[model samples]
Target: MSDQTLPKTPRDDDSVLAAEYVLGVLGAEERIALQARIDRDPDFARHVEAWENHLAGLNTAFDEVEPPAHLKDALERRLFTNIDSAPQAGLARIWNSVRFWRAGAFAATAALALLAIVTLREPPSPPATGETLLASLVTEQGNTRFVVLYDSSAQTLRASLVEGDTPAASDYELWFVPAASGGAPISLGLIGGEGEKAPHVPANLQGDFTDGATIAISLEPAGGSATGSPTGPVVAAAPVKKI
Candidate 1:
């Protein structure tokens, strides 16, 4: 896209630029660039907030309808069919999807409102060791399945499933892989299909959060890995990055 097509220059005269942003019309690159300005400019942030508040009213205009909690299986069968996960669908790819952006202004406003509601319900995480780090547990298909956030400020580790369906007869186990050349996987505990979890970081394991730490997820038995070590197929793993 042309650089001029994006709202790089946010000004009072171009206040509608905030509206376009709130409507999710900007591409990922454009969004990131505009976000940088929003972070540094207090007035611009307020301008964006005003747009969000104005757009949020659209959510109330229509009757609130909750989507079925477990629609992954059905949705995939219908949409994906013979396609194997439909490529990587990375942020950039999704941003460029015509069907996605074609949802237009009202649909985008509703989505933003829904996100706001979800964010409001998120409980605050306990402070960790003052340094923050995170790892995205991704599948071999290049899809991010879960995100593990290490809250050094709260001395806690939180994991949230970003994609994939919860197993009907099994559980997803979290594992920590040390940065050493040949480190064995250590079981952190089981995580749910959706939502966030603050798994118990054993006192012994607490000190093991190294700069090169990696997090892994495996499909395990109902409760968790029967053995202390991972005993199931490891589906995803990735090194943690500093926030």
Candidate 2:
């Protein structure tokens, strides 16, 4: 084909063009044209130098890891044996010929037939049964307030505390006080200042602890309540339903 009949180079805005081109991110025709210019002209090398400098900072953050022993061996084997220019040229010539394209169409048809048979023979799984709701407690400041999720019918509560956000100076304690009786509050467990925990509510007290019972968080000295009632001011309080 004549030079006038060949495809024209695409135009990019000059400011970002050189950066994008040197990053090996240009479309194929732009890459060919830029590479041709770099080969023939010395002045265009300055643009490439600027791109190299721009990308140098990015390399500092990358962590280098050694390749696996098997990968290195396989790469070395392929480097010496698999990548001959002669085979590549022969394959390209065959691909451009009519017979190779006809064979490719036949292979595609065979692949489609195998896929159809496999899909038809395979059976779909039955849907999973017995669904349950996920419950969580959170504070006004976007902090998670730890509490137990109770199976009220079974009168059982599984409790835990949120880690990291709790105060280090005092231990976070869980309290279960009957809302109706104003009765002596029972201590559930000592929750940590760090993370999630699972403590079971007392089996005997579980009968009296309704979902509407008041659950309170209070600061306690190292272990928990020495007395039968909370000594500190309520830092966090909610009904059992809050979880």
lDDT of 2 at 84: 18
Candidate 1: which stretches are off by over 4 Å?
A: 1-129, 142-144, 193-198
lDDT of 2 by residue, 160-233 (tens): 55322444344556677666675776777666322222234687876656534556556566566678577764
All models, RMSD in angstroms: 14.3, 25.8
Tens digit per residue, CA lDDT, model 1, 1-243: 565754555474447777778889989987998899898988878889999998897886788678796787676344322222333322222122233222322232444456557856888556544776665554544443565666765766666655655455567788887767787877776664223322545668777775556666777776777777777666666555554
Question: What TM-score number comes out for model 1?
Answer: 0.45
State the local distance difference test value for candidate 1. Answer: 0.61
Pick the TM-score winner. 1
Error of 1 at 63 (Å): 27
TM-score per candidate: 0.45, 0.37
